[model samples]
Target chain A: MKNMYEILINALQADELIAQVTILNGSNVGEKLLLWPDGRKYGGLGSEKLEKQIIEKAKELFQRQETRKLEFELDEGRISIFIQVYPPSPRMIVVGAVHIAVPLTELGKTMGFRTIVVDARSAFATRERFPHVDEIIVKWPSEALEALHPDEGTYVAILSHDAKFDIPALQVPVQSKAKYVGVLASKHTYSILHEALRENGVSEALLGKVHTPIGIKKLGSRGPEGIAFSVMAEMIAEMRGVEIT
Target chain B: MRDVMENISNWREEGKQIVLATVVKAYGSALRPIGSKMAISSAGDISGSVSGGCVESAVYEEAQSVLANSEPRLVEYGIADETAWSVGLTCGGTIEVFLELLD
Candidate 1:
């Protein structure tokens, strides 16, 4: 018999969507069925009918990317199973090596995100500055974003606070599947950038997706570290589906 | 779970019998969410935790029985549970844990 633990570790290491179904009730309590996205099965949940039903449910939960415990009324009895879905960790694309970006990248890693720091200046985006960042890209905003390819699990932060860099950086992420696209700027700067982006052919709906004056509201972060912390707090709230004031 | 696997592997190399416990479900504000796991060696060595600090001793006792019978079982704990006075969790939430022999 194949070890379920080995299969679990392998799926996790490969960043695959692996669903673990544990029967909590019925005659087969504690039986497990590990399902991979490719339809590979590691173990059985006792009966073929039950396994098929549970696999269909698992696929639905995987789409939502959530872990849930559910109860079903079968002829045998009421059966409960915990469907735990493990997806790849989210990615944080920090589009500046500024003071705020330094702490933001650190907070990203601490919060279990794969952090990447991108800057056009090689001097700023050096290994010494961000020792813990997963990847450091010494390229401009357009080129960096083109290579990074923001997806549903990606969070993009434009921390340069300069229109020259921030404008170009904001264009792609606003339309990408990134869950969050935030730009650090003041009220006046934000207004100007929004107008510029609108004139540059970005739709209002797309610009609406951008989070300006980034971070949780009323956080009152005075220092760069405090701002970074607030940003991470906002990211966490967004990820957990919690609304922030 | 990584911690449990690492220690379970080491215990297996030493020829020590072991049992595994996993938090299958957590309801109403549990500290550790579902899918948390722990391993118990026959020698009483423990790795990982399903609950932060509550109900571990109870799970440890259950592990002993599971290792003996080689049968998996489900155990639940909560603040106002039937075993409230004996091994109740003060976490104010319910957690269902499944125990199985891993040896």
Candidate 2:
């Protein structure tokens, strides 16, 4: 009987992704679910009935490499397994590589988001400034984002603070289902641009998802670091949906 | 247990015979948040996770076994829970655990 931890460490070391499902809260506090890409499965939390149900759920999230917290008590709370699915690390795509992008990229990586900084100007997106970035693309936002296969887990932050660069990056996520979409600008300017999105046929629902006045709160941030931190904070809120206290 | 790798490694440096447990699969919804892990030593010391607190006491027993026998084993919890009031997998999901002795 190979311990679940060893099996997973092997998988991760081999670059083979495996999802480990556990009971975080409620009943069945420590039930286990082992999911594989090849559809091979193992273990049971509590009941055969519940195990089958969780497997079905795990399969769905496994494909997306999504980590989710769920609550269930249909069996009258007998088996409440809060499944936290751990797949692979999610990737983040930044459309602009500028002065602020350098620090932002490094901080993003520290937070575990795979960062890619892109810019049409090679001088700005140089590897020297953004060493932590997994990839540096000297291309337009549309081209770079599309090439990255922007998905629901993808986070695209428009840090150029320029209409030309910001608009294209914003539009890409609007067209695809990028998880987090943010534009660096003031609230007033964002509202005007947001209105334009609706007029341009982008749905109101999607437009609402954009984080304008980017970042959490500009306590006293006036320089590039402040802007970068603000943007990163807002992005963190959007990704985790963490509410302000 | 990527998150707990540092702690496990620290214990390993101390020459602790560590036993690890991880949830490899999940069905419906389970508890303790999947991908959770727990590392235990033959000296009865432990860290990390596999589930919430409810099953830690139970899983520890198995982990201690690993430290003693130096072999891995698969353990199950909840089992399609029956009593809604008990501390079981309320999500109605199932999970499989793969336990290993980290030498």
Candidate 3:
């Protein structure tokens, strides 16, 4: 039991996704089963057959990153197990440290996201500008993203508004497995970017992934702060697999 | 669950028996989502919250019994009936919490 305690602490502190399964209702109530992200199993729920079923179920819920009480009918009887999943904070990569990125990163941190801001201009991407951001890279989007390696948990927002930065920033996430990639631009700017991306060999299918005019439509031209709010909200909706117009 | 790590560790090192109560399932709208946890020490020290203060008192009573007997229990609170008004969730949600002894 103490070993289980140690493992849970270490895994959470290290930001590893793991699940702790506790028998919520059964003769073996309070018995636990722990599962690692790599399919490794530790501890047990006291029955080999029951544990096998839970291992399979854990993987399913683990992917969705949800926690719930699951009831299963085993050879012994009906048992309810509480599956507690702990996933690391999702990564939010802001591709420009502009005025919007300031509030965007602040809101991102408040919402429990690991935020990074990348901009080639050191004057803009300074510690004083983004005090709460986890990382600030003063490299061009092309160079920064190459080392950043955006993955499925990453959410990238291109706010540079310049073709030099926006074009390559948009291109990088489209080629990666990032869940959400948004570009801040007006209709005229979006049209220009669309043509440039097409000329740069970004396929129509990949270009479709970019959310142009990035903030939620209901925001209605409020300014940088409100736009930042809308953009972060849209990013969250995308991360949760929600559909938005 | 992660925020109260230091408190949980200190409680265990002090040889205090502890009970962990976790929100396993929530129906309708809930303030806290499933997997929210609260740890109660034998001396009645609480480090976290399972609810947003709607039912911690009831859970604390339950934790005392769990620590005394080393037994685990699944408890449910909701506004299903007029008598349930004492512990009713104003948000009209039913939260099922699983309580267990943590040695």
Candidate 4:
């Protein structure tokens, strides 16, 4: 009984991946069709043929995770539909609740990411320290990542400077489908960590994906807040598909 | 859409008629990306924005007409448009906005 707008709002609120197709041109202007990833559809554009065409186009857009406007030529006339895909919001998973994690999480939240903080040190990963983070997990990085299941929409930051923690933390994200995995380490530390990860059986291809000495180059930024800024800049670049040499 | 959802829901709860305007296409350095949206209530209240304060007033006016007739419309703004120049996109971009009543 709910209207299409209410239904669309509910689906978005529930964090469900959905595609909304709006007829921008043609006799049925303003008509909409909602497509779920699981092949469920609602509403119509007045004709079975047009709906079928839109469903096919929606599937392709869903795969690309893109919003696009397409013009279709029919026997009657030209129909244009704006297809908008609503995916779950991206997440920022900080693997260490260090000083940088504070501003990093803050920046993540400001950038509309679901920020999470993880640390094995209970003393470090406290609500008092991360009062605004969406979630704080006081567990080893590997375990936390395993439970969280980092997906292609997740950006992982390994700020556990110590190798004992860093090595284990690096292992999980490097093998998972996380979109970005950045580590805060100096050149010397990165080389050492690189060897250790290789010893742990991480493939060269996967290890190559890890962003070392993390953050934008030549930033000249120093200290916790500065480093966090650079790291976030790099993450944004990655998220927006911008390449920075 | 997410950015304007809270205000849209609040306006809906107050029984205000609403129009949702979305930027369906942006060409040349548009300030807001495609799919950016703004919600306009019948009382002239607005939430979110589709441009960098360049065209909200114009879009708001169009939304009022849509609310009156319950007809959706597509509006375009560009620096080259003489009428749009009065409330043009200072960013020198062309944008096509789709306005529809939120039923």
Candidate 5:
């Protein structure tokens, strides 16, 4: 038991992403689930079998580094386990750093998110506009997106709101695990642009992730700044699993 | 927790008695994840966390001992440890703790 403690500590110190499941209500009540990278396991929430089974489930979620509380039915009683998945923070890629990019970039920075802004036009994509923004790439979407490595938490917002720019930009980030993909556009523009994506072979499921008119539903008069706030709010809602309801 | 490191070091150099209690490891449902750290000083200053409000009390006691002994130690806590979540990770997850005392 003590050796298990040391091993777990070492793994955490090395920055390994591992889920820690606690049996909140059960006979095993305090048993642990220590699942390693290779799917091998140690410790138990109850018995070896229960631990093994939970570990397998944990590994599946661990790959994505998602957090969820689990409820399990056992022969002896009803069991509930709370699982906290540990994955690295996702990157946020903002296409076209305009006035709206300023607030979005600042918010992302405060929230421990890695933010990137790209623009084909060097004048708009200068470091002066986005001082704290990471990776100011002055290139087309294909060039910039190809260079960026997208993972689960990657968020791409098509702030360009320009067809030629937004269209090309969508191709690179749409397929990635960016849970929140927001494009700044009005309802009419989104309908038109979304159709364009569909025609270009983007699947309905993938296109569904594209948040056109991204952000919380407008509460008052809408403009460029309002649109930026709403879109960022939407991104935050999606990132933290928050819903307006 | 990384945010608290510099402050903790600053206070240590200032000669305030301090101890660091870190969530070195957590099992299933920890309030704070592993690697979360909280530094508590003799003056009752604190920064960061191991669990939510769940485990701070136990951590404080362990921290005080480390401060008194002037030695580092590990405190293992969980629902199964017979302590039964008394001022601990009441979320039922177990956490292995590392404590370092500073002069």
Candidate 6:
């Protein structure tokens, strides 16, 4: 049996999603309840009813992915509990060793994402090219993504504009649970790739989720860094759930 | 809080008395979001930040008081026109910080 602080530090070090509920008011001030999304719990805030209510509120905050303070009126008095969620660090998976991948990886790293680069070309995916990236998988995008298990916290960028690579790269993330899947392509190239994917039996709904001609609109810039900037901007907007007109 | 966890652990291992301050609530354009934390040791060392160089000194003082008394406190800071030179956020935001001694 571990103390609440030890349990919290362990969960954080393991990159597990956990929530901390702390009573801010009432007699239970400074009381804490640590909760996991799977219903695992540690510590308590005294009352069973209060704990149940805090668990329910923690679930809602987990869905919202935010820290919030809620006021609850109990039979004894009004209690305010602050629910703070600790989610795993987000990841950025780039499926290319192209020039944009360099700055894109750098930007992702700077933005606090665990950046991984995937490419079949051993020479291009060398550590020399991506010194700061968390991982460089010298394998095909499909295989790398399959092993990586991109989840809701993952953002995938298919920067290999070549059809042979881009098509295979797009196949995994577009259909996976990745939060954002974007592809770098010209309008002409995207149409061709779109048709090719559709021909390969990809559904319209899934294909519709893919961000082709990737990056924010009206970027009005050219070159690798500019494109990376736009792509990161788009990814940030998607991560923040902001609608970009 | 994540950013300062390692430091907090190190301080705890060294048998240092530590106070943890967390931003429990924010209003308006708060520079730091809710759940941001700052850790202060009895030796006056600090880790992480609760605001963009605003209200931290005040929070530090409050942390010292909490360390001395072993009592938790929730303090609110907001910009006041009358007390223009006081400790408050220049970003025109209000933030409530909870300070507690970390055992």
TM-score of chain A considered alone, across all candidate predictions? 0.83, 0.68, 0.84, 0.87, 0.64, 0.83
Q: Give the poorly placed runs of model 1, Cα more than 4 Å off.
A: A24-30, A70-80, A126-128, B1-20, B38-49, B60-71, B82-88, B101-103
lDDT of 4 by residue, A29-117 (tens): 99888999899999888889988988888888899888998899889888778999988888999988999999999999888788999
Fraction of native Cα contacts kept in each candidate?
0.55, 0.05, 0.86, 0.73, 0.00, 0.59
Each model's DockQ?
Answer: 0.51, 0.10, 0.75, 0.81, 0.09, 0.70
Task: Kindly list the per-residue Cα lDDT of model 5 for residues B1-103, writing each as its tens digit.
Answer: 4346556657766778878675656788877766577889887788877776777877887888877777666678888776535665568788877676642
Each prediction's TM-score versus the true structure = 0.80, 0.59, 0.82, 0.90, 0.60, 0.85
DockQ of predicted candidate 4: 0.81
- CA lDDT of each prediction against the hidden true structure: 0.85, 0.70, 0.86, 0.91, 0.72, 0.88
Of models 2 and 6, which has the larger lDDT? 6
- Write candidate 2's Cα lDDT for A27-117 as tens digits: 4555666778677876667667766777788778777776665555556564335454555555677777878787777778767677888
Candidate 5 local lDDT, residue A215: 71
What is the per-residue lDDT of model 6 for residues B1-103, given as tens digits with 9 covering 90 to 100?
7678889888888889999899999888888999999999998899988888878888898898898899888888887533323864688888889998875
- Per lDDT, the best of the predicted structures is 4
Worst 10 residues of 2 chain A by lDDT: A78-87
Query: Lowest-lDDT window of 10 residues in candidate 1 chain B?
Result: B79-88
| Candidate 5 wrong stretches, greater than 4 Å | A1-86, A218-229, A240-245, B1-18, B23-35, B40-47, B50-65, B71-98, B101-103
The digit string of per-residue lDDT tens for model 3 on A146-221 reads 7988898899999998987888778788889998989988899999989988998889998898887897887674
lDDT of 4 at B88: 62
Candidate 1 has an lDDT of: 0.85
Candidate 3: regions farther than 4 A off: A1-3, A63-66, A72-77, B2-19, B39-53, B60-71, B81-84, B101-103
Model 2 misses residue A125 by how many Å? 1.9
Model 3: DockQ against the native?
Answer: 0.75
lDDT of 1 by residue, A1-245 (tens): 66786778777656687888888767888788888777888888778888888888887888887788888777798888888888787899999899999999999987768899999999999999999998999999868997788998999999988898988889888878888999999999999989989999999999987877899768887699999999998888777778776
Best by DockQ: 4
State which candidate has the highest TM-score: 4
Candidate 4 has an fnat equal to 0.73
The superposed Cα distance between candidate 6 and the true structure at residue A16, in angstroms, equals 2.6
